[model samples]
Target: MPVHRSGSGTTRRSRLAALGTLLAALSLLLTLPGAATAADSPTAAAKKPARGSATMGMGVIAHDGRGGLPGGTLVAQTEGVDVSSHQGNVNWATLWNSGVRWAYTKATEGTYYTNPYFAQQYNGSYNVGMIRGAYHFATPDTTSGATQANYFVDHGGGWSKDGKTLPGVLDIEWNPYGAQCYGKTQAGMVSWIRDFVNTYKARTGRDAVIYTATSWWTTCTGNNAGFGTTNPLWVARYDTTVGTLPAGWGYYTMWQYTSSGPYVGDHNHFNGALDRVQALANG
Candidate 1:
């Protein structure tokens, strides 16, 4: 499950499913009247802070060209632009004041396409964002995973940086324009995913972070031990309310719980604050 354009050309279905699950559960609890107390609320349950936790880092995918909230910093990565040039004008001071902790500049695309200027721009921009970062491709075609990894390493510089990055993310989702990726049988999809993850780890010497939907996880990689145990999961479940994702999978490191936020330029763009992400990362 690699990140792909949704039919609506916005947030991924995995994000929608996560949000749907939370809303459904919250609706059920509300209907029950005495389902849970404030201390036991689902929102509270999903947001309980981790012990000895660090401040949460907010993230924003600055793909579409648009300015968001001036404060509450965003992590914007360009596919082919020199991201460094925009560093000085990125309003980092405002974001820091508003509570932003990290930013992941895009480094590469499909195996053959590299963000030509990421290297020149993101080499050491950590001081601008609380945490600096880099990311790679997550294609549905496992055969291409190795190629994508190699490209990311060769082009994105192997996620090497002076600052601490939230694990390198493999954005697994739907690719509506291409073939039917989600149509693959759960086992087949899991196998493909495992191939990608294993290949990436072998090449990068770093654990790959999986970004996908809960349904994708259950239907595709739920039974695969490789996914269930080896890597961290960055789940996309966009709902009005937040809560723990359904069980059966391993630990999650981030949750993209919404698509409509001031920081998100598009109405359907993906957006999730840092508290949940930090919880997932540190959980």
Candidate 2:
């Protein structure tokens, strides 16, 4: 059985700290213009969309039996081994068949770092799979976030043929480790976010969506007038119906309501209201 770990108490803060360090490193490396050269450019081969020319319309949220909630159309990167290795272990095929149209595989984290499992799965199936696919980086801090994002673009190699990703997401939550970031204040966090987002957008020319829990959103960038409205928000609220989301967050394109779902190999997951996502993207 997979061991389940809860993000409660001191452990949560500790995890955040470790993740912060990882992200900081990633940001630095990706910010470099020639970090990965040809692979890093957006001109690389693009992957085909799963539903032909028809847009599937829904979104997704992924869980690794942990607290990290990455929103997208297809959710990959469960715990244990990479998705391909445990093909028999997790019923991803079933999930795909059951309306899960895309998969965002975990690509990299902090600078000079990549998820070992993600590397395997991405290299093996990202381009060849029928399900439209993209990769996400577990963003740490500014410098690391840039490096990790760059690494993902460089190594993942390719774009969506239709110019739409399976969905590229930036997993932004409170650092579990609670280590004081160089820029931990609200302004600092917002600046860091801007730096990361701007860098990724410049390189990929794609809108890099922001993924955050209610608390993180409210705490980090709520006060910044420019932060909240500039990018598409993928809000994570595990409980309550989507209808009951906080008043100010109606603009959110996707909601990660249930971490536990049938599609994600029986692990906790999230879903997108096809209509809402389309409306937001179109707007």
Candidate 3:
């Protein structure tokens, strides 16, 4: 069942004492590269994609009193999904009925491919009362991040203040071409990401949401800890646990826990309350 705006417990006591210890440990883990713990490390099991119907949903609260989240643990969260051209002609009304409160859609890919259905998908999401966002499939090897960001913005990746739009996303995961890091060195990859996000922020007045896997980030960017403070981290892990986050982020804002869910595209969770998600959309 989808936890709605009022579902989060209002009377939950503060966990400041426990949070302090966890933050200290996390701070240490993020500083050093390849320092993730064994359990948090992406396991073979983590690679399996999620399987379920639109009726099934998972949230940021993957572990409820059973384990930890990116920032120790959160008291509450909500479930959502992301779509692309791959999921053609989404029934937004049906998705909303299936417990999705928000969604992100692919708007552009590699400065060349704009999602042919972006107009409908992006508008359809909002028409159904779902918070909608736009993301770009990055191709850092073909062109610079700034150039790609501009292309994304020029297409359909821009944001609005209607309180229904989430920040633009930079999807920098597996390389469809050959080189996973887009033929760039680790430092070059980091610089590329900086250029993209910096340009995104300058254009939209908000930092871009970073969608990436832990291993990819580690291998490509040396698990750089720079973006966590500035941008929201959208971590991708397919298993039951989130495992380790990228170096810079203390907690993840979104988790793509499964590529296969009740939805057509990826299943996700917004790791905060409805109002918090609204705030994210508001910005």
**Pick by TM-score: which candidate is best?**
3
Put down candidate 3 lDDT per residue, 1-283, tens digits, no spaces.
Answer: 3454335443232466567889999898787987777677786546433221111112222322223223444466777888876678999988899888998988887766778778889999999999999988887887899999999999988888889999999988766445567789999999998999999888999889998878788988999998888899898877667888989898999987776678576787789878888999997
What is the per-residue lDDT of model 1 for residues 61-173, given as tens digits with 9 covering 90 to 100? 22211233223433431111112222333444544454445555556655644554454335443555455456554555534566666666676635443334444667665
TM-score of each: 0.54, 0.55, 0.74
Q: Relative to the true structure, how large is the alpha-carbon lDDT of every model?
A: 0.48, 0.47, 0.78
Candidate 1: minimum summed lDDT over ten consecutive residues — where?
Answer: 51-60
Model 2 global lDDT (CA atoms, 0 to 1): 0.47
Which ranking of candidates, highest lDDT first? Answer: 3, 1, 2
Against the true structure, whose lDDT is highest? Answer: 3
Off by over 4 Å in 1: 1-90, 116-125, 161-163, 222-225, 242-250, 264-283
Query: Model 1, residue 207: what's the lDDT?
Result: 71
